[model samples]
Target chain A: AQKVTQAQTEISVVEKEDVTLDCVYETRDTTYYLFWYKQPPSGELVFLIRRNSFDEQNEISGRYSWNFQKSTSSFNFTITASQVVDSAVYFCALSQWGAQKLVFGQGTRLTINP
Target chain B: EAGVTQFPSHSVIEKGQTVTLRCDPISGHDNLYWYRRVMGKEIKFLLHFVKESKQDESGMPNNRFLAERTGGTYSTLKVQPAELEDSGVYFCASSQVGVSSYEQYFGPGTRLTVT
Candidate 1:
């Protein structure tokens, strides 16, 4: 069985502040993939990033960055200088290689107050 | 190109009522998928379609749900006699073949409210 756990249920921060959302996963498979998605108030899910198990290198894209630590079985996302438009429900998901389904976490609701 | 699109952005129905949700994948994508998220719960996979064939449907909750994709184009999921527990947001996604990235384009989702 595969599972993704996002401990933070909700977080609020003022505009221009940085926020980090935690994600932990459990999987027996030796090879797997991890992903992060953002769901805004419109209810559409936007794919953010995808990381493979073999590559534990940290990734950064503009104001968004991700830390992948195979040692901790954790994939954390950080948003620098978050704006009001960045407020959304962030999800952490896992999938085994060639697997048909994606296992998702409970998600973290982020609110950025301007 | 347009992304995945789902019909009836929102639906409200009583218990034992029937409802149908539709999804139109990208113009040339061959992989289609369905997922749902109940209130306060994690999103779950319902099924997957490779072209017009059902690749996997192990996550479908029960027999009351039926899905079909004709001519390997649009897909439909019909829930006969929906129950309270079936109330949730249904999401549709699609991916192109040979895309090993496992990245899927998602739809806006259809919110179903069962009374």
Candidate 2:
């Protein structure tokens, strides 16, 4: 059974604050993929990042960074200096190598007040 | 290139009413997928299609839901008799073959309301 757990249901933070969203996954396959997506109030899912199992290197993009620690089965996302535009629901998902379907977590609703 | 597109941005129907949702995948992409998020819960996989061929549909809840991608261009999901539990956002996504990246492009989901 492949599952992704996002423990935080919601988080509220003031603008310019840093926030981290935790994601833990369970999968039997040795090779798999992890992804993060952001759904803004506008209702479109924006692709943020994707990490493969073999790549353990942490990724940083602009004000956003991801810490992938396969030892703990965790891939956490952090937003530095958050802004009101960063308010959205973030989702963590897992996928098998050949499988086309994505197993998504319950998602975390984030609100950044200006 | 146009992204994936779903018809009927919002729909309100009775519990026993039938509703059909359409999805047009990105051009030149062979992989199309259907997923749904019900009652603010986790988004779940419903099915996958590759060039009009049903690849995997293990996530489909029941027979009340029917999906088809004729000629492999546009797809449709029809609920013969929708249940109250079917109320949620239906999302459509597409990805290119051999992209090993496992990245999927999504559309602005369709919100279905069953009363």
**Candidate 2's error at B97, in angstroms?**
0.6
**Global lDDT of each candidate:** 0.94, 0.94
Worst 10 residues of 2 chain B by lDDT: B95-104
Candidate 2 TM-score for chain A:
0.98
| Candidate 2 wrongly placed segments (more than 4 Å) | none
Q: Interface-residue RMSD per candidate?
A: 1.3, 1.3
True contacts kept of 1: 0.87
Q: Count of backbone clashes for each model?
A: 0, 0
Q: Which stretches of candidate 1 lie above 4 Å from their native place?
A: none
Q: How good is the docking of model 2, as DockQ?
A: 0.80
Chain B TM, every candidate = 0.97, 0.97
Clashing pairs in 2: none
lDDT by residue for model 2 (B40-97), tens: 6899999999989999999999999999999999999999899999999999998888
